[model samples]
Target: MDIKSPLPFETSDKAHANLFNRMVNTLVENDNVLSQQIEGITNETLFILKGDQAIQDGSVSGEEYPIGITFMDIGQANDTGYPTRYGFVKNEKISNFRFVQYYYGTGNEAGNYFDSTGIWCRHWWTGSGWTDWHKLSGFLHTNIGTTGKQLLTKAEYQKVLFNRKIKDSHNNFDIKNNRFICPENGMYSVNAGVYIESFQRYANFELSIYLNGIRYKNIAHHRQRPESPSDTGILNTGLYGAANVPANKGDYLEIYIYANYEGDVSRYVSDKSGWFNYFDIMEIGGRNFPRV
Candidate 1:
């Protein structure tokens, strides 16, 4: 039989000759029957239109499948995306589709068991196309104490309470050269009488008064006093003095004494000296009040 080869008969046409040569080269290179079968299968199965259709039609509407929706295993390896669990739904894009894991529990109660002790569980978000995993919740719990009795926040306790002595001074009424001024509008009775000025009450305090740089007396509210002088001379006489004046809303009284040498003391002796003498007067103390 005189067989004819499938070569280009028109040698004058270069394009047709080139096409024929390419066809012959491809056939010679893949001469196996398996290669021919594979080529046929690829041509029948591979369809770009199907791929485009799948991409356009495949969409995950979160309303239909809420969080924690489990997905069954599809036959294809690529289709098996993620395990179904309860958690946040993220990255609802076409390139990535997945299900994240989540859980909730209380912290270590009395017995290290997860109970209702105001502690929360840990959670995470993961998927196929996502590069990194994320933490949606932590294991630590917060203390929600009772209202009004709870600890004060930084913004609530940012203040200072101030208590200051606005004015403090002492008047010496008996100093020979030194004169004394009355803090109140009261009669200055110079005799064996009491002179009292109100002051703030102090608890557990040390009070001291000086006469010409000499330590006159030191006394507290709860201490006993020494015996009075019998001389009646009144000079350097130890007098029973007190500074304890009770005050509810913080008030105080101060007191001093002077002898009227011109009065009834004239019946005593030769020097009827009822004139005022030099006496340096002052008072100082502190009160340990309760803290608010």
Candidate 2:
């Protein structure tokens, strides 16, 4: 009678193969059907979840979503939610033994990937849940504050890491200690710049990024010598230095600056223009946190 329209296959024996392939294709077309596809999948098995979900044709009307695990946008598109979180999980239980969250950065304000918001990632070797997670975060701050007018003594060195005012995302940078605590073990970019002025000619100044209380040698630092104009305009020098270095959790960095002047002294001028004596620190997200 009706032999199921002859089922597209070489022979009746290949009908099962055709059925299996069609089933997989269907599973790859609609994420809504993911549950049915993985009904017999094992824990260690990995599968692609593809498809055009909102549309239907028993075929991918848009994006082809494979089956097994799904990278659903539970939150707003592009993770622009009041705050976006990223981590891998299978159904709620931990997958790849991780679950990281950020408490800071609102709606794409961005905290350079991982931020201070009590950021914690699951640690399978230790345990699970909220109590058993690892702290991984990024920090940002500047060297601007209250105390002003510090004329460097000849050949005097100092940690010019802070002014009288401050803004710390996670308390990672200690104004009191003049140190930036490494929030996580990863590659970081340390940068420093100062708005300086030399009343007399031939003023030599140095600004640097120090890691773990030691001088960072990766970035070669040259002395800054502000030129004395023959006219009434005072000479102002913008000193900048940066370095890319690896740091372990709890390791720290500092901004050290010095001046060796034979005639007049060098000074940390005012931040009237918003670009005076500042420092920047950022974790290399592309290197530290690879896409999961």
What is the C-alpha lDDT profile of model 2 across 179-264, one tens digit per residue?
A: 77875556777766667665545556777677777877433334534465232345566677678777776788877776765453
Q: Score every model by TM-score.
A: 0.14, 0.49
**After TM-score superposition, what is the CA distance of residue 202 in candidate 1 from its true location, in Å?**
19
Cα lDDT computed for each candidate against the true fold: 0.26, 0.50
Candidate 1 C-alpha lDDT tens digits along 168-210: 1222232232223332212222111111121122112122332
TM-score of candidate 2 to 2 decimals: 0.49
Off by more than 4 A, model 2: 1-147, 164-167, 218-233, 264-273, 286-292
Off by over 4 Å in 1: 1-9, 13-21, 24-132, 135-146, 151-292
- Total clashes in model 1, counting residue pairs 3 or more apart in sequence or in different chains: 21
RMSD of each: 32.1, 12.6
Candidate 1 weakest ten by summed lDDT: 142-151
RMSD to native, candidate 1:
32.1
